[model samples]
Target chain A: MTRTSDRERRRDPARIALYVFLLASAAFFLLPVVVVVLNSLKTMDEIRQGSLLALPASPTFDFWRIAWSSACSGIECRGISPGLFNSIKIAVPAVFLSVLVGALNGYALSQWKRPAADRIMLAITFGLFVPYQCMMYPTIVLARTGGLFGTYPGIVLIHVVYGIPYTTLLFRNFYAGLPDELTKAARIEGASFLQTFGHVMLPLSVNMLVVVGVLQFTGIWNDYFLGFIFAGNENAPMTVQLNNLVNNTRGEVAINVNMAATILTALPTLLVYLLSGRYFVRGIAAGAVKG
Target chain B: MTRSKAPARGLSDMPESGFRPDLVAIGFFLVVALVFYGSLLWTGYLSLTNSRLIPSYEIVGFDQFARLVATPRWRTACVNLVILGAFGIAGSLALGTLLAILLDRDVRAEGLLRSIFLHPLALSLVITGLAWRWLLDPVTGIQSVLRGLGWSSFHLDWLADPDTAIYALVVASIWRSSGLVMIIMLAGLRGVDTDIWKAIRLEGIPLWRAYAQIVLPSLKLTIASCIILLMADVVRSYDLVIALTKGGPGFSTDLPAKFAVDHFFGRANIGLASAASVVILGFVASLLVPYLLIQRKGRA
Candidate 1:
C-alpha cells in the first residue's frame, strides 16, 4: 500500500495518463445509469428534441409515481406495486429458509464427520454448476405432480432448493475457518451434536448469517426466470414486472416511465450493493476460491 | 452446564434433552439431493422420450436428439451461444484487467471510481437490458442523439438488425459482468509480492515487462477462475436475452437457455427442451470439472 502512495508522489506522465484512462472508463461504465436517470426525469418532447446525453429541461418525479402506481403490464394496468409486494413476500421466506438451512448444513459438515460426507458435499457443489435450465423440465413436472406449479410456495421452494448449494458452500467455508479445537472441546465436555451446534456453532455464525442473508435476499429478489415460470402471473416478482413494463409493446412506449420502473425494480439490490458490497465480494470470493 | 462431568457419548447418538439439530442439516441435504439430482436424472430421461406438451413414459430413443440437431432455430441458438461466450469472456477479461491495473495505480477518488465500476454487478440483467435497449435504440437512442449533434450520417442499428442483435447481447453482458472481473483481478493484483516490485525497479525493468513476465504468471489461478465464471454466465444467460430481444428478429439472437425456456413454456416441446438443457449442462460441466480439480489440487 505504501508502495502505491510513494509512486503516486512522483509526478510522471504515465500516472497522468493512467488517471485520464480511469476517469474515461469510469464514465463509460456509468453511462447507462446516467442515461436512464437523466431521461427518466424529462418529458417525451424534451427527450425527442435532445440526445440521450442531454439534461432534462424540466425535471419531474411524475414518471416515478406513475411507474410505481399505474404503468401498464399486459392487460393489467396496475403497475409495479403488486409485483413489488410479491417479490418481498417471496424473498423474505426464501432467504430465511435457504440461509437457515445453509447454516445448519455448514455446522453439521464442520462438526460431524459422517461417512460419505465429502462425496455428498461434492455432489451438492456439483449441483451448483448444473444449469438451472437442465433442472427446469423435471422441476416443473414435480411441482405439477405435487400440485405446486405456479404457486407461491413452489417459487419459494425453487429458490430455497437452488440457493442451498451456494449458502451451504458459504457457511461451510466460514465454519471451516474456525479452530476445530472448539468443536473437539465441546464434544469432550459431553455436549451432544445438537448441543454443541446450538451453544457453540450457532452463536459463532452470527456474522455469517448477515453474509448469507444479503446474498440470498438480493438474488431471490432480483430473480426473474423462476418467478416468471413458476410463481404464476399473480405472484410474479418485480423483475418480471420490470421486464413486462420495458418489453411489453401493446401500449405506447413511455421511455420515462419505463426507465423509472427499471430503476425501481433494481433499487433493492443496488442498496445492498452500496451498503454491503465488500461482504458481497467476500461471499463470491469464498465460492470461487474454494471451488 | 453441570453435564460437563459426564463421559462423552457416541458422536451419532441422539440427544436426550433438547431438539435434534442434526436433523436440520441431514434433512435439508436429503431433500436437496432428491430434488436437485433427481431432477437432473429425470430431465435426462425425459429427453429420450417422445413427450410434447405433456411428458410421456414411452421412450423414443435419440429421435428427439436427432430433431434438435436438424432444427434450424436450435442450431442458430447454439451458434449464438458460442459467439456470446467467446466475445463476452474475452472482452470482459481484457477490459477488467485494464481497469484493475488503472485502479492499482493509486489514482484520485479511487473509492468512488471503484464503486462506479462495480455497481453494474449489483443490478439484475433485466434492468441492464432495459437500460441498454433504450440507449441502443435507433430512433430515440445514441444514433439519434449523434444525429441530433450534427452527425446526421451516423448509423447504429445493431439491436434491430438480425446480423448484429446477438452482438448487442454480448455488449450488455460484458458491461454487466466486467466489474466483477475487475474487482477479482484487483484483489489478485493486491496480493502480488512487494519484493518482486522492488526487485524489478532495482533492475530498472519496465513496469509493463515486469507485470507481463513475472506478475501475470503468478496470477494463473485468477485468470482461469475469471474465464470459468464468465463461461458459466454465458450458459445461464436467459434474463438478458429475454429482456433484450425475446429471441426475435427472426430468432437471430436465440440462445440455448432461452431456447429451452421458449420450448418448455411457449412452444410446448418438452422433449426437445429437455435435450437442449442437457446440452447446456454438459457444456457448463465440461468447464467446471477442471476448476474443481484445480481447487482440490490447491488444497492438497
Candidate 2:
C-alpha cells in the first residue's frame, strides 16, 4: 500500500505521456463526430463561414428536421424519412428471422454427434468469410428469376441468408459450451429434440439471444452495400438515402443537411451501442476470437 | 437401478426423436451449399464467359480474366486494396494495441475514453467516410480552419488528389476499426494471467521488453484474429470508397468490390464484373483457408 502510494505520488513522465497519447487518440476518434454534430446544428451560412471544428454559434434542430423530412435524397425530396421506416421494417424482421434460424441451426448442430455435422459447420463458418460481391451477381440473378428481386421480402431473405452464418456461429459456439448432461437429462425426461430445445435451451439462451440480436440489428441497420444493391430504390435503407442526399450533385450543396442526415442515419446503431454496449462488445469479441 | 436403466434407454431412444433435428440441420446445410457455394461456382463460370448485360453461355475460357488483368481501373483497384490492407491493418493494430495497453493500466475515465474510441465503430462506413470527407475537404474543412488560425500553409486536399485519395480511405477505415481492435485486445490483455506480470515484476524486466518478448507473443491467436477481421474489412471495402471518394478523380479510390459492382450494374459488363468478383473470392480464400487450417490444427 505504501509503495503504491509512493508510485502514485511520483510524476512519471512515461505515464503522463501515455495518458496524453490515449487522450489524443480519443480526441482524434471523436473529431469527425464532433465536426459532423456541430455542422449539423449550424446554419449553411455558418458552416460556410465558420471553421469546421468550431461550435455552432446558434445551434438549432432545423437541419435535423429538414434531413428527417424535407431534404432531397435523390430524385425525391422526401428526405430520409422513407428510408428510416424502410430500415426499421427491414431490420426488425431480418433480426428476428435470422436469430430464429440461427438458434435452430445452432442447437441442432451442437447436439448432433455425426462427423457430417462438423463438415457442415465448417462450411457454414467458411461462408462467414466469403465476400458478398462474389455472391451478389448470382443472388441477383436468382432473386430476379424467382420474381423476388426489388421487393421487401426479397431484402429480408437476403439479410437472413447472409446473417445465418454469423448468428449460427455465435449460437453454435454458445450451445457447444453447454454441458452435455443437459441434453442427456432432457432426453431422459422423454423430451423430443424440438421440445428439449424449446423447453431447455431457448430458456437458457436469453443472454446469447440478446447478444446475437443486438449484433444483427446494428449490422443490418448500418449496412450500406447490401442495402444499396438489394433494397432497390423504394426499400433503400437510411445509409443509402443519407449517401444519396450528401452526394447528390444537383442543386445547392447543403453541408448542414448532409451532416444532419449522417447523424440521423448513425443514430440507431449508436443508440444500440450506448444502450447495450456490453452485449455489443461481447458479440464482437466472440465473433473475432472465434472466427 | 431404474434411473440408470432409464438413462441407457434414453440414450438408445434418442435417435427416434433426433430425426427431425438432423433433417433440419441438413436442410440448412443444403441451403447454404446452394446459395453460398453455388454463387461462387456461378460467378467463376460467369467469369469465363463473354457475358455482357446478359448471361452468355458461350465460354471464352480465360479471356475475361485476361481482360480483367488488362483493365487499368481493375488494376488500380487491386493495387489500392493492397495499399489499404497493408497500411490499414498495421495502423489499426498498432494504434489499437497501444490504446488497449493504456486502458489496461487502470486509468481514470477508462470507460469514458473507451466509449469515445468505440463510438465510431457503431457508425456505418458511409457516415465515417462522409465525416472524414467533410473534415478533409480543403476549402471548407481542416485546411481552411487551420489557415484561419494563421497556419497559412495548411493544405490537406487528399480527397481530391488521385495519388493521395487511397490514404484518406486508409485513415478513415483505421479510425473506424481501431476501436474494435482495441476492445478485442483489451479483452485479451485482461485474460492474461496476473502471475506472468508478477514474475516479470519480480525479475525487474523492462515493461516494453516484457510486452515485446512475452505478452504479445502469447496473444498470437488474438493478433491473428484482429488481422483476419481487418483484412476482411479491407477486402470488401466498398461503402467507404463510394461515400468518401466515389472512386473519383478518375477511379483512384476504387476497390475491387466497387469495381465489380460498377462493371456489373453501371458499365453493364457482366463478364468483367464476374471476373473481378472471382478474383476477390480468390483473395479471400487465400487468406481464409490458411487461417481455417491453423484453427483446425489448434483445435486438434
Candidate 3:
C-alpha cells in the first residue's frame, strides 16, 4: 500500500472502476464453466429443479463416475473412455508428424530458399483457409482409394496435412528470425543440409517446438469435426462421443452426466492450457501474426 | 536482411549441379500440393457433375448450383451466415478492443486476469457449445435460474427458439473468440509508440479521443488481420454449431458449413454439398487473397 504515489491515490476511483469492469468480464467468461461444473456435481433431481447456477443440495461424484464408465450410447453402455483412448492415439501421432513435417518445410524455406518456394509456400498456406467441407468429399474419396478410410491412420493423415500450414508458418517465422551465420558457418565446414539442421537449427528451436507442441496438442485433441468424419465408430474421439451423449436428442436427457462428460472430455486440453499458459500465448501470437 | 545478404554472396549458394532442387523438400511440397490442388480440382469436378450418394463424373453443368439456390434451407443457411458473421466479427472486435484498452492501463494481477480471459481458446468448440447450450437452455439454465430468483418473466431461451438461435451462436462464439481478439489487440496496443502517449498526455487529450484518432489508425494492420482471421473462423465454423443448436428449431441457425455437412453426410447429396463447399471457398478466398498479399509485402 505504501508503494502507491499521491497521484495514483487521486486516480483510485478510475482504477477501482476499471477493476470492476475487468472482474465482471472475467466472471462472465468463467460463468459457463462454473455453471457446468456445479451442475455436473448435482444429482439428476437437483438439475431437474431447473436452477443450473444453484449450489447443489447434495454434491456427488456419481455422475462423473457414470460418465466415465457406464453412460449409455445406443445399445451398449460404454462410457467415453474408448473415445478418450482414441483421441490420444490420434493426437499423439498427428502432432508428432505434423510438427516434424512443418519443421522440415520451414527449414527448407528459410535455409534453402528456392526461387519458386515462396510462391509455393504462399499457396500451401492458403490451404489453411479452406473450409474442411470443401476438402471433405475428396479427402474421404482419397482415403477410401488408399484403403485408409475409417481408420486411425486416415484421421491422422488429415490432421497432419491440415496442421502443416500453420505450423510451417510458425516455424518459418521462427527460423527466419534466427541468424543465417550459423548455417553458413556449418556449410563452410563441409556440413550437409541434415547436419546443419540437426546440429545447429534444431538445437536452437527447442522453445518454438514446445510452443508448437502445445498448440498442436490442444488443437488435435479438441477437434471434433475431423474425428467425427474420418475416425469412424470404433476410433471416434472423445468429443464425438461427448456430442453423442449430450446431444443425442432421442435419449432421456441426463443433464448432469452430460455436464460431467463435457468436463471430462475437455480436461486434457484445459490442463495443457493451464500448465503451459505462457507458451500457449506465444503459439497463438506466432501462428496468427505470421500465418 | 543482413542474413540474406551474407548467404547470397557465399560459394555455398551456388548450385552443386545447375538448377538442382531439394528433392526431400520438394517431395514434401508435392505431397501437400497434391492434397490441396487435388481436393480443389476434385471438389470442383464433383460440383459440376450429377454426383449423388457416389461420384457420377458425367458433367451436369450447374444443376446442383441451381438446386442449391432454389432450396429454402440453403437460403436460410446463407442468411444465417451473414447475420452470424457480422455480429460475431463486430461483437468480438468491440469487446476485445475494450478489454485490451482496459488492460493497457496496467492493472494488478494482469497476468492472472489475462489467463482467465484466454483459457477458452484452449477448449474445443464442442465444449464451448455444450457449456453454452446448458447455460442458455430455458428449462435447465439461466432462464430457470432467473425464475427461481422470482423473476417470473425471464425468457433467455434463445437456444431453442428458431428466430433467436443464431444470436445464441453469435454470443457463444464471441465468448470463445473475444479472448483471442483481446490478446492480438493487446499486442497491437503494446506496439504503439511511447512518444505518442507522451504527446497525448502533454496535450491533455481524453483517453477515448487518443485511442480513437491516434491509437486505432496506427493499428490498422492489426485490426485488418484480426478481421480477416475472424472472417476465416466464420467460414470454417462447424464444431460449435454441431455441439450447440445442431442447426435446430427448424433449421433457422443453419450455417453453410453445417449445410454442406448435412448434405454430404446426412442427406447424401454429394453434388449439392460440393457446390456449397465451393461457394464457401469463394468467400474465404476473397478474404484471404488480400490478407496473404499484404502479409507477403509486410515480410518483404
lDDT of 2 by residue, A134-206 (tens): 7888998889899888888999999999988899899989998887688888887778888889899999999
lDDT for B125 (candidate 1): 82
Q: lDDT (CA) for every model shown?
A: 0.83, 0.88, 0.86
On DockQ, the stronger of 2 and 3 is 2
Can you give the lDDT of residue A231 in candidate 2? 87
| Residue A56, candidate 1: alpha-carbon lDDT | 90
The number of the candidate with the highest DockQ is 2
Return whichever of 1 and 3 wins on lDDT. Answer: 3
Docking class of 1: medium
How well is each residue in B59-107 modelled by candidate 2, as lDDT tens digits?
9999999998999999999999999999999999999998999899778
Q: Where does model 2 exceed 4 Å of error?
A: A1-3, A6-10, B1-10, B13-15, B297-300
In the range A95-199, model 3's lDDT, one tens digit per residue, is 988888888778777765656767767877887788888788888888899999889889999899888788887887788788767876777677777777778
Question: lDDT per residue, candidate 1, A21-119, as tens digits?
Answer: 888888888889999999889988888778889989889999999999999988888889999999999999999999988888877765445445566
Ranking by DockQ: 2, 3, 1
Clash totals for all models, in order?
Answer: 0, 0, 0
DockQ of each: 0.53, 0.62, 0.60
Clashing pairs in 1: none
Could you give the TM-score of chain B for each candidate, in order?
Answer: 0.92, 0.94, 0.94
